[model samples]
Target: MTMSEPLDPNVARAAKLDTATLSDALDKLGIAGQCYRIKPRDVNFRMTGRAWTLLYGPAGKPCGTVGDYIDDVPPGSIVVLDNGGRDNATVWGDILTEIAHRRGIAGTLIDGVCRDTALCRQLGYPIFSKDHWMRTGKDRVQVEATGVPVNIGDARVAPGDIVRGDADGVLVIPKEHESAVLDTAEAIEVAEEAIRNAVRGGMRLDEARKQFKYHQLQTRQEG
Candidate 1:
């Protein structure tokens, strides 16, 4: 079977939680999932789904296409492009954005950069990346591989990994530990909510935090 599995219910469950909560859960589980430096192109953009990874490298004698593999991405899957953090060239742009939006792809996450910000913003297509640039990747980069493991920011993302992004940033959840991560995140969310409610009810902030053991919420737990 391919590394990418059928969409998991955990994807749905993850959508309900923000990246901060999920990041904390990953910390508690000792999983390095926070995709540092990867930010949403638009503050309002958000997405959660399985990763469909692509790896890119310096262009060869005969440069390959930048986005041909996008057509194969399944609906509801996020396109993860690893461009080695090159900010000089863009691997994604208007055409790819239009196609992905129309195809029902969840979103695009790039380790490097993208272009055509206006189109992406206009279509409400979610894209998280290091940044956006006008220079094209056409002759600067080539598709090195697809459906393989890739690195986004500093986090490793394998095909089928759960990716969640929002205004805060992106976080990758390893498929093998998705359940544990989600469970921990939900508990953290509940505890945080309770603390908030207690504070709203006139309880001292310190007392609420002490009551919920909030300081230890994201502490690594050893088995």
Candidate 2:
């Protein structure tokens, strides 16, 4: 989706759904979106917003700054930093956290690492990343591009793509497929809820599963 396009309402609905259901939807649709090896700093942390992507690369001869882009991020947007999964240097820190929180930015998602996590926890700001470290990215890495497509784990994220994350990790829903993905995910959630209700009402677990066609929830939908 273009940056100027208003976010789809389905994006908000998908945000209410967990990564597992969204992953299932993507699987059913044959889309690759599950980001591997990335996790939330705190399991309780959760974030959902349109992606505002940034690509990072090894610094040049003189090196470059780490986070001058924070001031440009819009509220409710997720800052997606692709650092090629580097764990040694952090692209996020307390200063960025405070500003982002104050500005109402939804959260930060990094394919690399972050630092000064204590402030993040204190402010209840969500941060999903590969890991955390104290070494700053100042002299090691620099922003290669902004408002461009970037990789997070194995998933490709573009500007305005819907980014949803939680304890299970992050998944990017391609802007073009947001509607279909959210529809499938909501259906799956409904079917699973029904199964739980049946089991609670004394139905055999196997019986409930069969009634809900549980095994077919993630099966690829046929044309």
Candidate 3:
């Protein structure tokens, strides 16, 4: 199917995870499925708090720009927008980042380009997007609706799903699957840490890996 094909972004299921546990989960999951943060934004806006999900469109002309969602987002929620991969136009800018941060929004994940990198950097906002651009999304695009399904890489994200991002990248733990995945991922992380200690203490790679069975840990078990 095309990336922009119609899809329902709904909280068909609810997922929950605490901040302290999620860190452990990500550690075990390792760098995966996320957009591999090539270059970081300097904006001082940070996605404070633990885990908050923002469900959106998979493409199909999602309504509202990055700014429009800022007002509606609750504290600690992420602003995930779908702009189809039109890397030529920029959908997010400095003003939106500032507003989102003040509103206590966690961060933003854009399927398109962003503008005002230096401003974003200064504001300390964490943005995961396709590219950075100097152009504004004026006539280029506009939101057709809010709270819809948007394609973020290989996954489908909806409102209330757990979206976790970091220096590695971003991962969407479906609302239905988040709790189980988080639990499994935590155990995997602990085992990996044990392996890390083994390596640091002078054990051989194969020996340490075999002792931990690192290759066998599955963080996300598709149900």
- Among these predictions, the greatest lDDT belongs to 1
Q: Highest TM-score: which candidate?
A: 1
Q: Find the 10 residues in a row with the least total lDDT in model 1.
A: 1-10
1-223: candidate 1 lDDT, tens digit per residue: 2223235679879999999999999999999999999999999999988999999999988777775877788988999999999999999999999999988898999999999999999998999999998999888999989999999999999999999999999999999999999999999999999999999999999999999999999999999
List the candidates' TM-scores in order: 0.96, 0.94, 0.72
Off by over 4 Å in 1: 1-7
User: Model 2 misses residue 108 by how many Å?
Assistant: 0.3
Candidate number that wins on TM-score, 2 or 3: 2
Clashing residue pairs, backbone N/CA/C < 3 A, model 1: none
- The alpha-carbon deviation from the true structure for residue 112 of candidate 1, after best TM-score superposition, in angstroms, is 0.4
Off by over 4 Å in 3: 1-67, 218-223
lDDT of model number 1: 0.93
Candidate 3 lands at a TM-score of 0.72
TM-score of 2: 0.94
Q: Kindly indicate the candidate among 2 and 3 with the higher lDDT.
A: 2
Judge candidate 1 at residue 8 and give its lDDT: 65
Residue 93 deviation, candidate 2, in Å?
A: 0.6
**Candidate lDDT (C-alpha), each:** 0.93, 0.90, 0.58
- By lDDT, the candidates rank as 1, 2, 3
lDDT per residue for candidate 2 within 1-223, as digits (tens), equals: 4332235586669668999999999999999999998999999998888999999999998877665888899888999999999999888999999999998888899999999999999999999999999998888998888999999999999999999999899999999999899999999999999999999999999999999999999998887
